[model samples]
Target: MHEKKYLILYSTQEGQTYKIAQYMAQELGESHCNLINLHEAHTVDFGLYHTLIIGASIRYGRFNKKLYRFIDRHLAQLNAADAYFYSVNLTARKEGKDTPEGSVYIQTFLKKSPWKPKKIGVFAGALLYPRYSWFDRMMIQLIMRMTKGETDTSKEVEYTNWEKVTQFTKSIEKSL
Candidate 1:
């Protein structure tokens, strides 16, 4: 029997979403899943894959505009397929804000688009101080302080919970 093909595509700014996509692809295995960055992929033949997992990182409380446009442009094909969408953001790492805020973000995006993915995930993002510009770094630091998140800007921090990500992926696999 031929193995089913899955496409894991993501849009990342500071590389956290990319890392999560990589982890999902790795866990799903290269033989069954092909991981691609939205920036690197010019065209996607939706009919060629059995399932598609689209991911995007949140910046300024919204998803990447490019990702939103891609989904909007390919809504028909994506809706016809076994599709899943995951949104990653710093708020998703917070104790009480992750699920609700993530849901709101997804719902707002879906309201503007036509496609409704079968599964949705909200994963925690990271704070890469080293990767941010001086202005962004200071702004994020201030936001973190306001939100009672990690205040020390001297070190890079990752707030993602790998176990939750793995469990979510496994659930999707089973459903498929």
Candidate 2:
């Protein structure tokens, strides 16, 4: 039996989305999935893969512009494949905001995008205050505070649900 090839591509700001893509690729098996950073990929032949899992992190309430451009350019190829899209953001860490339908950023992106994937995921991102610049830290801190999230600038807090990620991957495997 031939296993379908899969691409796990990510556009990350603080590395959470990249880490999620890498972990999903590892769990799904290295032979079945190829993990790539969207920025460095430069060129991707969508026809090479049977399934596409695209992930992007939200920075200042917006996804990477390159992500939007890629989707626009390869919408047909991506739609032909069994495509999945996941959004990573601190906003998903809030109560009642964990699902794709519940996430403001995800809803906004999906409404604007022409490519609608087979499955959508919303993952809670991390708060790496130590890695942020002063301006970003302050901005993020204010946002978090408003959302009732962790506000401490000295500690890094991870809010991702790995079990949920594993389940999502298992579902993707089943799709093949």
Candidate 3:
């Protein structure tokens, strides 16, 4: 079999998205993948990769601005490749289908961009209260209370389901 080329590109605020990208890349294997942070990736030659996975974390109900810009800059190349997008947010773990806000996020991006990824995954994000500032921590705590999510500020909390992430990655692999 010929070697496969995959690119896992991601942007992270507090590292959750980065971790997920790393996990996906590791599962995909070193030889087949090139995992890069959006900030570090200046010029991406999309033609060099057969598959591309882009991931970004949501903060205050919006995907990372840098990731969006990066995608916008390379929209044509992305659309030409086998591409997938994963949005990491706390709302994914909530007990409903895509919330109005989440739906808006996806729709807004789709409307603004030329690229329509082959697959879109929304994974639950983490609440790293310990890493937040006092004001942010309190605000997030209040948001958590309103959302009925964990509000514990004493420790870090991860809402990501690794098994689901694994399954999602495998699905991408199968598609490729």
Candidate 4:
């Protein structure tokens, strides 16, 4: 039997979303997967892949505009394939917010977008205060403070649960 082709696309600002995509790619075997950055991708031929996984980070309570545009442009192709979607956000670090139903961003995305994936994931992202610009750092710090999260600008914290990620990847593998 021929090897199944997988398309992994990611839209990341602080790179956490890309990190999750990389983990999935590695778990699925890099040779069988084509990982593309949505920000840099000009066009996508969804027909070339048997499965499509699109991951995007939530920035200031929204997904990247490019992700929406891409989905709008290729909604039919996505719906035809075994498509999966995952959202990365710090809010997911909180209890009861790590599922699609609990994640407001994911819910908003589903309601606002035309395409719905067969599987959905919600993962926690990192907070690198030192990596952000002054304005962003202050804004994120304020949000963190309100949420009772780590607000130290000098520290970088990663909140992703690798075991959950592995489980998600394994689910995809089983589907294939």
Best by lDDT: 4
For each candidate, how many residue pairs have backbone atoms clashing (under 3 Å)? 0, 0, 0, 0
For 1-176, candidate 2 gives per-residue lDDT tens digits of 66779899999998999889988988888888898888777788887888899999999989989998888888788878889989899878776788888999988998989989899888898999999999999999999889788889998999998887888888888987
Q: How close is candidate 1 to the true structure, as a TM-score?
A: 0.93
| C-alpha lDDT (0 to 100) for residue 46 of candidate 1 | 82
Q: Can you write out model 4's per-residue Cα lDDT over 85-117, one digit (the tens) per residue? A: 999999999978999999999889989999989
Model with the higher TM-score, candidate 2 or 4? 4
Output the better candidate (2/4) by lDDT: 4
- Models 1 onward score TM values of 0.93, 0.95, 0.91, 0.98
**How does candidate 3 score on lDDT?**
0.84
Estimate, for each residue in 77-146, the C-alpha lDDT of model 1 and write its tens digit: 8878999988898877866556634466777877876778887888888988878899988999898888
Total backbone collisions, model 3: 0
RMSD of each: 1.6, 1.1, 2.1, 0.8
How accurate locally is residue 23 in candidate 2, as Cα lDDT from 0 to 100?
86
Tell me, by TM-score, which candidate is best: 4
lDDT of 3 by residue, 1-176 (tens): 76899999988988999999989988899778998998889999888888999988878877777877887888888878899998888877864534334555676777876678898877888889989999989998998899898888987889888888998899999997
Question: Looking at model 1, which ten-residue stretch has the lowest summed lDDT?
Answer: 94-103
Q: Model 3: how far is 71 from its true place, Å?
A: 1.8
